[model samples]
Target: MQFIDFKKEHFSHNKEAGHYFIQISKDEVGYGDLEVLEKQDDDTYSKARYELVDDVSKVTIKMKNPGNIRVSF
Candidate 1:
């Protein structure tokens, strides 16, 4: 039995410029992992960077399936 199941996990950040999103695997959500969803070259870049920080806050875990986990920062 599993507690969660998802076909894909997504991460995103919203800024004055636009919204950036990325699909991440469960294995990548760990300490010292540098996950880059998008990069912008403008004044909004800093804001976007800030928004991206701590994006994985709500994470769901599932049994049996290695990829059936969700992480929100």
Candidate 2:
């Protein structure tokens, strides 16, 4: 839910800016395996393995039947 909220607030801005990365993980802390979602020049989404830096925030995630996965700013 926190991630959804973050998306509602920030995703649009990032989309408009045209250069942003969305860090995806199996936990809020993002310490384990992770992925990065990015918008390409064709305005499509792409994902890849990535390791986030220390600045990302952690919050409880609530979603329907998820694998405890989360997306963060």
Q: Model 2 — which ten-residue stretch has the worst lDDT?
A: 59-68
Best model per lDDT: 2
- Per-residue accuracy of model 2 over 1-73 as CA lDDT, tens digit each: 1332234223212345343344334354444433334444575545533334444454233222212223433
lDDT of 1 by residue, 16-65 (tens): 53544444344545433332222234312111131223345422222221
Give the C-alpha miss distance for residue 62 in model 1, angstroms.
25
**Candidate 1 ranges beyond 4 A from true positions:** 1-18, 33-50, 53-73
For model 1, what is the error of residue 13's alpha carbon versus the real structure, in angstroms, after optimal superposition? 11
Cα lDDT for residue 51, candidate 2: 37
